[model samples]
Target: MNQPHTAQDDGVRQRQQQIAANLRALILSGDLRPGDRVPSTSDLVAEYGVTDKTVQRALAILKAERFVEGQKGRGVFVTTQVPTVVRASHYPVTSSEEPYAWIADNASRGRAGSIVLLHVGEVPAPAQVAAAFDLEIGTPVTVRHQLLSLDGEPVELVWSYYPSNVARGTRLAEARKIRGGTPAVLSELGYPPHHAIDQVSARLATVEEFIALRLPQDMPVLRQLRVVFTDDDRPIEVTVMVKAGQHFEVRYALPKPE
Candidate 1:
């Protein structure tokens, strides 16, 4: 048997919603511009005469709606209002191309940059990872993981994988030798990927990821997975990127048919 909600409980729920709506209006009205500082959780609790948990609930609602973003050790801020566009196409690498240079260029348009290279090494592929790359179980693969920063703050973490057969015995197999970029090395090996397919989703982070991303205890994350393919339809590489919900935007242009 379920207990019924009392009038007092209903009143509390209504108040929480009202608080969230008020904040939403302020953000949409240009009172809080992009990168503008928002009141701290403690301040919100005091100002609204609400408990800390209630204030956090309201903020969580705002975050899910994409109206605000939070930074580690930094208070929450009004997020830039930008439409997210994702390009679902392939980019062929040339001998002169750099693996992440193109992505870095794209980020530059949004004033973002790569910050940390967490881990890069060859390891036995996990079952799911091997399947994604069309490899047999236990095949060795080279994995390059990194965290990207925007304006000196961490924003996203990226994990890239390549089959050992594609990277083995090549300069790319050595982390130091190809530290500059991956596409350049792949191009040199005659496997220049020309196309990509990307998939996106939203979810909460795991305990380890939460700490690694430095996300707040209750915050969510956005996940993007991309598979790079050659013009001949051969799978060349796979990349998984996780972004803090507030600071990340995906942008692309739709082509008009002639």
Candidate 2:
């Protein structure tokens, strides 16, 4: 039987969430380094003015989300694997000299990154994808599904779409990997990307994402819908990117106000 919702339950849940948020902020801000021991449960309870049970629940949340681990007879410690910071404004100068821009970027950060082309074929455009392409809902489009990894661990899943008219008879529709990635192919086709806009959000992982990203739980994922536009303001490509939220954060470089 389902239990009735109550105000006390809501209060407890909010307090637990507050505790977890505080610890998460500290870890992400580098105030608590990897392998650093988190304060004891009794200490946290004292600090947060919550019961020991509430503190334990908050710690469990962190453990399930890969932020911390508990050791025998010892308190919780930050996991050795820390969150990766992605520079939102970085883009590769695509050329034969540097084909895989993403791999190169990760290399610069001292991490080995690679991509696996899981699928390439025609599919009915999803609602958002169709809208980006200025087509009616359920329009057909060429889609490429890829899984991106860092240090052999899955980090992101990407699905890129192109209108059939734009991608037909081109390498974009091919099942094999593109030598210079998609930007080079688009450029050669006279639709060089002039700019891109990204819409980002966070939500609990879907079943597919949980399995693909190997998430420890139904944790949140960072989702991005990016639309690339070329000369004449034509939408050339639409991409959906999903990353494990606990392990990734986007950083933007903002200009100073005049």
Best by TM-score: 2
| Candidate 2 local lDDT, residue 233 | 93
Give the alpha carbon lDDT tens digit for every residue of 129-242 in model 1.
Answer: 787788887788988877776556566787888987777777666654243377767767888767777887889887866777677445568888888876588878888888
lDDT of 2 by residue, 2-75 (tens): 33322233454478787887888899899999999998986776676778898998998888777899999887
The TM-score measured for candidate 1 stands at: 0.66
How many clashes does each candidate structure show, in the order listed? 7, 0
lDDT of 2 at 47: 70
Colliding pairs, model 2? none
